[model samples]
Target: MLKLIVNNLKERKIGLHELNSEELTEALHYAVANQDFALQREIGNHFTHIYDQTDEIPYWFKSEYDDDVTIINFGQRDKVVDWSSVTLEDCLPLTHSKHKPLLNGFKNWLLAVSDPLENGGAVIKTSTVKMRVEKVLSLIDAILLRSAALQLSLYHLSHITCDFWLSLFKAMSENGPINGVYDFTGRTVELVKAHVKSITQEQVNAFASKYPFVIRDIAEDDLTLHLAKQERVKACCWLYSQGYYKYGSSFIATGNGAVLAILLFEGKIASPSLNTPTSTELWLTEKERSTEYRPFNTENSKTSTAEATINTYISMAKLINTNIFKDNASSPSIEATKALSVRKINDLVILKPAGRTQTLHPDVVFKLTRQSFEFVLKFQQDILDA
Candidate 1:
């Protein structure tokens, strides 16, 4: 049983690019070792919605954002949780009506358990134990499989009393074999014992050190660590689903009087980057990044909370205050505006707050042409030129 517990954690080691601390790693272990439903929820939520900390978000994200974000397909990997292995049907109890916990027993357990997040112990009432167990298992599996990370943490995994966890798994195993529904109980233990090449603390620390998302907060660093990897960004996607900036890619084309910053997300913006060079690098200042935030609505259900998401994003943007955006266009606009001289056409800077929760790039690319450079230099933020 102990081996199974270790293997469950080992299989879902943290990602190399993650910016978590040893405390988080240990906390994750604690969740698995104990039957802490809140911790399990945290693990599941993180896996389903991590963003690429550094990926750029295009300008004018305040516009309507629509994205499906990352789809957690269980079949895609062989992690301990194996989301693909279990189906919704499989999760449903054989006879939910029959197995509902007896009221007195449930109330008794509820009082005994305490959540680390201060959400009060998760209630396993007679009405929801079956579903709750399934949910808990899902959370456990996700963390155990997805922890395949290399992010830094601040604590160490310690030995904890897991008699409750053992019983829970044993019970889940009996309910039609937790093969696909919560198999980590057995597999995770094996992986940890064997010293598999899962995520390492050094890797996680390196990631956080590079991004340093905030002055001294987990949210910002979490964002930064997720982004520095350059690709396969997890943090960015996490934000999109939260409805931060609307997501998409784009093609930049410069004309004589203005620059064309075409949005990849199929939508319309009444006022985009104006023709003025001030619009050239559409960068977001500290104030702007802090102000622009949205809510998460993956299921579009009222149950989804966006406050935690907003705080996380605001914290992250501060870390990448000056993260540079690449110039998409090779040529400059040649048109000249009345107010300013047409000496140069610099790159455009686009600011992305925790813009949205979807698969999106932090910035977009714009091609520069000589004609467009002249246009931007001569033009102003006025409508006549834009």
Candidate 2:
């Protein structure tokens, strides 16, 4: 486990040699400025250890480091300096940069959770288990660091919930393919798609081997209202079994033929709401009652329904992004939503959202939301403005 962590640190260019006395001094000042006594102690120990060493120091450290005894001894010596009164500006070059602070915070959190000494050495016993936990922590730390560097808010990071991580592990362990779509809520479909693409099969397998769990496969069905309704119910039930029941959304990544379904929970509920059927549902129902399978099975109706469903999802995606970001006082330019269009080529329904295109097979049923219909009414006005 120790070796694995060391290797990962090496890969990230965060080796022990990278932690110079100067950087450790800066960390100490930052901790002292924040009045974080615990962090101050940790940084102080590192700073004192590095400064006391007679051996060669890291390249980033200054050659005349012996001259600045006052800065180095700020937190190390017995001299009483008021931590609470110290402002950030007083720290000067000792302060961490924008993303570094968040990265440091995440690293601290990871260490706290995984450190056996802090947990009374009760959480982890075996080296194998420890290595697995560390791997997950490293993956999360990397994601958080990237998000911080990109200037994404804590709210955006919050969306990568514990459930999402658990589901990822489940997907890895389960040999059968998981059929689901990405949640398009909060205009995060593009971000989620990028993340999905970045994930390697090897990582999934490794996570799965570490923690094995079963995830039931969702079978593919023809694109129809009846099928969509049935699949939605099945999906909700599966999620409920996994202790997730609240909000649900799906998005498809046409490039990789990947579908991700995300389920979120808030408060407990006796039952989830089942709203009225859509026009496609009505058409399916009418066809079922007429005993005329040929009319309902016609290529024209299949193409039309498929196109309608894709359009509905695209509109909903736009509205969701608009409302979420607007509330947060940020406007996200969603080029994918703006470029969304659907066309029928012969019996097939082709959806082009941004540059990526997806063909809706007759065997797949696309899910739709109430917001999709509501937004479609003003589609023309919205498109012209965009």
Candidate 3:
């Protein structure tokens, strides 16, 4: 078994070599988070022992597999199936067989109750069984890790926008010494790609093998969060240009890797060029706007086009820069409601709001208190005028 384990690891070693540095971190999360296999055996064994004495078979007490049904002297008999390639249904020729699966179950129950204790009823020892538990746990971890690797299901990045993600990547990707989220001295896409290269799978596998229970499966929650962010990205594209002007750049790369600001198309053009040493803005046209968009990392649902997604972003920028930023405090209630909606719209995060529902469009919705709704509008106006 040890040789088998070692060989499995060896064969996978080459495949893991291709993991980027960040991908490796997520992979490690999968590898390290699960319960030991010993626990499963202990739990399974306990069930067996309990059934041995009860004699009264619980309705829930079902064997791993099923056998055929029977009709015998006891009204209806059941045939119990042991480990075999043939299923219980196939084992007994229904035309001739008088017994069914129920009979086997009844018999087992009778056996259990007839002798709750065996020859003075001593406890069974299981220390030897534990020796291989760690190995089994490790093997299970590997199986899960491989599954995740094959499917790309273990991305654990925070629920931030891609613009922010890009910025962080830029900071971490640079050459030379790095420190935390700040690495301004280095710049360029190549630097970020290098950091991405740092991610791998084996590191995740080793860590996941340690905890075999709790973190057993890839987190579907994270995927939902990502999908929500994707929706936001799409919104930024489709909203009022996301506040852009002049050169028409769609996003802003900034903060020495600490932050990435996605410059959406602003509704109105600033007096000067969109980007100067101090300012950068993105631009968009009317066709790029969106009403309501879906969330990201979709495990369930139809796929949306990237172009459609971009439209929302553009609309957001234009709306903010024009109506919201440019001194338009027309609907303080509406603006606050928009932000509240943006922050938690059809996303993974479960946000339960108090009060009434504000329906901006057929696709967009908002749940907010009256006061909070007003505050959002005022805040949006401030951004526009600022």
lDDT assessment of candidate 2: 0.32
- Model 2 regions lying over 4 Å from their true place: 1-96, 126-386
lDDT of 3: 0.28
Off by over 4 Å in 3: 1-196, 209-222, 225-355, 358-386
> lDDT of each structure?
0.27, 0.32, 0.28
Instruction: Rank the models by TM-score, top first.
Output: 2, 1, 3
Clashing pairs in 2: 180-259, 180-260, 181-251, 181-259, 181-260, 182-251, 182-260, 221-363, 222-363, 223-364
TM-score for each predicted model, relative to the true structure: 0.16, 0.19, 0.13
Shift of residue 145 alpha carbon in model 3, Å:
36
lDDT of 1 by residue, 143-218 (tens): 2222223110110011111232223333332332233233322432332233323335564455445434311322
| Count of backbone clashes, every candidate in sequence | 102, 10, 96
User: Best candidate per TM-score, number?
Assistant: 2
lDDT of 3 by residue, 1-386 (tens): 33333234346643334545664444444334544344333333344564254344333224421333211111233322221211122233312233232223222322222232321343323331122222222221222222222221221111123343223222222221121122221222222323333334453344335322212232454332122222222322322232322224434321111112122111111111112221111112222326474333223222222322222332222221122221211111223323322233324222223444332443333433566678878798787788
Among all candidates shown, the one with the greatest lDDT: 2
The local distance difference test score of model 1 is 0.27
Cα RMSD, model 3: 31.4
